[model samples]
Target: MSTLTEELANTDLLWDVPQATLEFLAEHSAPRTLASGEVLLCPELENGHVYLLLTGTLTVHFGTPDSPMIRELAQGSSVGEVSIIDDTRPSAYVIAKETCRVFPIHRHLIHQLLAESNPFARNLLQMLTRWLKSNTQRIVSDRMQIWELTDQVNIDGLTGLYNRRWLDNAFPRLLTQSWKKGQALCVLMVDVDNFKSYNDDNGHLGGDRALMAMGEVLKTTVRPYDFAARYGGEEFLILLPNTSLNEGVAVAERIRHCSESKAVAYANEHSVPGITVSTPLPNITVSIGLALNQSDSVSELIAAADAQLYRAKMDGRNCVRY
Candidate 1:
């Protein structure tokens, strides 16, 4: 293995530093060994020295110990520079991604090096700049990744509509808002007519495209204040605030007519080899059920809409019932 001074001489941060200053760092710095998954700095607890990574990798995370990682420090990288320079608590947790060795450089030692060599000072400034820039880019990248993951969690991938998970989370809040503002609330339950038979005649892929088309129709039909979501397979729901039963029924009828009049098409250019689909697919009809918010719970309101939906199906499909 190379001696501490030998390793320090190889590092860009220290390469331009004078031999005398490098010797000072080799003498003052203490070696550290971390096990895989070992935590070096806890954002909530520690505010301390920077580390010169000699071997292995370190990951940085914000928010909590189990939070998503924001950045990684590779071999020959510096860690904790941001906290050391600012003289504040670290905004992130630093952990070892694998067994690692590091040199913990204290603030006093850094100050001594600054005084000893102008080259060392310049090198340190450059190192800090690179660290800051890298961290800023990582933060932005991490934010975008987090947003995409959150969207995947709340949105239906097949139809590009809000999923049942989002509806369950958001409906209570919407109901509370309506109650507080003394405004009416309404729910529309929509289902494709004979979707089972449709899926049997046309494959699941065709059914998916049909559902996607229905989703688009609802997207273009609803008002800006309205909320629409895929309740489950072949079922959709819309929430309308400040809408009466009559208004809700009218919206449901409009959606029903629109769905009946439209044709769905599917063709994926990027589909697997030898996999192809027909375009300008068949037209389909839908049955809609409406219910106004009553002096009852959300479940009861949904049940009311479901009951009306059954009535619509019994009265023959492609119609709205309330």
Candidate 2:
């Protein structure tokens, strides 16, 4: 069992606390271990305990449990402080990415420390200020809005990926940055093979599910900095910054294989109130076209990818063209 004073000494939040306060904290805090995939905190939970991470990784997600991750915290980082400070339910989910060891500082201990120790109080104030600033920046960059109207802007509601509007605005800037950095830029246009026929055989609802699955595949396959969008309908676009054409083609093939082996499982609605049936969709295939940034303009690069996509469709669907 690691003492709280020893743990607090390594953490940023308690860096400047006096030795006495650290001793008090160590005496009050207890060691805790969180296993991988365990949720440490969530929105509805009103627990007023903040934790100091000792080992492994934790992921913070806003909105819902399945929402996009906003931050990843490592050892020596603090978790749940915002909720504790605000005296409100957590607005985010903190999940352990791997096995984690933590020391939890409950609200009562925190209040006692703050009342007895001026240095501890000051350190907490500084930490809260920095946390607020960091969170504000993330909210702006993520386009995660609190209001309803601003929510319509950056993301695709159906796929939960960046929308065409975001792509249109971001691509040019990405291209410029790549050029300035002398890095390769690769673009891929992906299309679901025999999608129209599948839609005809299945319903539009089936088509929607197929599209959503494809979006998820793309989301998982791309790098963190890579931009992916549902470029309208069954067509999806991926932008690979600092990636060679060869690397991009390889990524496309990996996505292709992943999609090929994957099945979409859905349920059927029956007219009979009590009856329901489950269906497993056939493994889906996608045609991919990859292009390196060969021209000065973003439009030219997209057009090259489009041309390659056409070529892929022509050269027997379910293939990659570059």
Candidate 3:
């Protein structure tokens, strides 16, 4: 078998290191053997030494040892260097992928090498720079994936509008902002009038087209700062900031008229064979309930608007109520 200094000379991190420095490192550091699945470093634990892999493979995991691997280290790779350099705990778990041999260089010895050996310092700095770049790219990729997933979760697939889940998460923040700024905030509960009867007459597909058209109308009718979301089947909600009771009523009337005049185009199910035909569906109307924020509570504001909606539905539908 070769001497420890000869073994150290073959490793990438120790390459070009002077013979005396290698001899000193070999004399001070000891070789450690780890079994498969052994934890070499953990985020919650302090690591005082940098490890140089001499045989087999190791893996880095962010959350736990059994979690998906974030990175892999080969025989020439080094681990636990960041913790020693920054005097901080490890940021992730390093595990032995299989039976492996590593040389554990203590922090004091690493500092000595940095001060005494120019080649060792240069090699370490190069390794750290590469690691930094790799980590930055990984963080950016993760953020993009998280944003995509959040958008998918918060949007309604059928109407391409914000869903109830998004509204629930956002309403409290909007309410807080209004309270802090002392600005008026209004809530509108808009419901499709005679929706069940319309569904019975036009079938589910026609009803779906009508709802989609209604969604487009709301998106275009609301102000740039206003928020619109699908509250539930056949119902939608809108939030208007910096608006009084009068302005809220005016906005609600606009939505009601827009819904009443809008005609949806869909494929006629009764079209003749071998030819497709497009037909305009009958117009649909909406009953809107408006309420200004008086209680300074999200649930209270929504409840007040919902109560007005019930009144609108009771008073022969197709009208705005406050």
State the lDDT at 109 in candidate 1: 71
Candidate 3 lDDT, tens digit per residue, 1-322? 2477777887777989989888788778789999999999999889999999988899999887789999999997899999999999999999999999999999999998899889999989999999999999999999999999999999888788899999999988998899889998999999999989888999998899999999999998999999999999999999999999998999999999999998887766656888777788888999988888885699999999999999999999999999
Clashing pairs in 3: none
RMSD of each: 5.3, 16.2, 4.1
TM-score of each: 0.72, 0.53, 0.78
Point out the worst 10-residue segment of candidate 2 by lDDT.
142-151
lDDT per residue as tens, model 2, 62-89? 8887788888998988888777777988
Report lDDT per candidate. Answer: 0.85, 0.84, 0.91
RMSD of 3: 4.1
Stretches of candidate 1 exceeding 4 Å from the true structure:
1-10, 15-106, 115-118, 203-205, 266-279
Q: Which candidate should be chosen as best, given lDDT against the real structure? A: 3
TM-score of 1: 0.72
